[model samples]
Target: MSDYIDQTHLQIYNSNVWAYGNSKWLGYPILKYPCDLFLYQEILHEVQPDIIIECGTFNGGSAMFLCSILELIGKGKVLSIDIDPQPNLPTHERLSYLKASSTSMQALKAAREMITLEDTVLVILDSDHRKHHVLTELNLYYPLVTKGSYLIVEDTNINGHPVSPDFGPGPMEAVEDFLQSNTNFIIDEEKHKFLITFNPKGYLKRIK
Candidate 1:
């Protein structure tokens, strides 16, 4: 019965992911699972981070979503990074778009400049999903996450943790590699309490 439930969950997850490709927020494309988005809100509300460094802004829908939540929280700003310029991105006072590689020094400098010692920070890595690129991003951004905050690695479901089998050494592999040497963070399995998530074993919470 447990195996049957697991199989059913996977089937539903695959279908949801397929439909999620077309998902949008306020008419802007947002490539994220609905369950994860729900979890994001829970995290945002709990952390109340002063800064959210999002390493990927496709059409800016997710950034916009984050901004909306921050507005409700009445504090916080989003620094969304991406290599390509997205013309459709919406204009928001709380959203800053940086056109640079997520792991580039330029990007790092900008992020550092926006953060202060007193601020609580959260990082969301959704940019390059390749193993090396994701690993580099994990290393570069993990330090910015304040104690008790989160470093979310998205799309770990690819490379066959149940979806996109041919994606090849993606975020999941990068996360596993990152954890082997990093002890300050641990996978917060509670984040995925929802049965379906794009980020499997990807929610790393800073303990110290």
Candidate 2:
């Protein structure tokens, strides 16, 4: 297991899997680890959140992928936010797009308006990976995550956790900082069963 871990690190460093530049879901670019996506489906199945607030939309593949899973589950909606809109995003009845800074009040207001007090929400932070930005996002969105749901912070493997040594403090750092004073959420290691996730320690479940 130790040897495999070392080899995985080397592979990630050599191939830059953190970028996921060529990966896609249903033909649309989706820059995320397939392992993490599988874990997401598992969590979605277990938690069954009514709303998913995704902070980064990119090419919208991930949003579509989430909606696909939700469809199979027979419920749920995805609200994907991004600063710059892409050219072609897949349209789905369960998907909504917001073009705005994820940490901006406009984005927060939109998310709040879409979610009712009775809704169980799951939040994903995948935009502006810098520590400060992610931390701000964590503060702003964590409240939306209902008990037993997740507030996923993606790309935690970067910033030298195993790859992209020079990327600087990213999602992992943000999560660490957020956990210091917050007790409502806890890192759910079960999500790491796949062992090849980009989001190390990123699956934070609201436990309070």
lDDT (Cα, tens digit) per residue for candidate 1, span 1-208: 6466456646865675446446788888887777888999999999999999999987899999999999999999999999995797887899999999989999999999999999999999999899999999999999999999999999898888877788899999999999999999999989767766779899999998
Put down candidate 2 lDDT per residue, 81-189, tens digits, no spaces: 9999688889999999999999999999999999998999999999999999999999999988999899999989888877778999899999999999899999998
Among all windows of 10 consecutive residues in model 2, the one with the lowest summed lDDT is 12-21
Clashing pairs in 2: none
What would the TM-scores of all predictions be?
0.93, 0.94
Candidate 2 residue-wise lDDT at 193: 80
lDDT of each: 0.90, 0.90
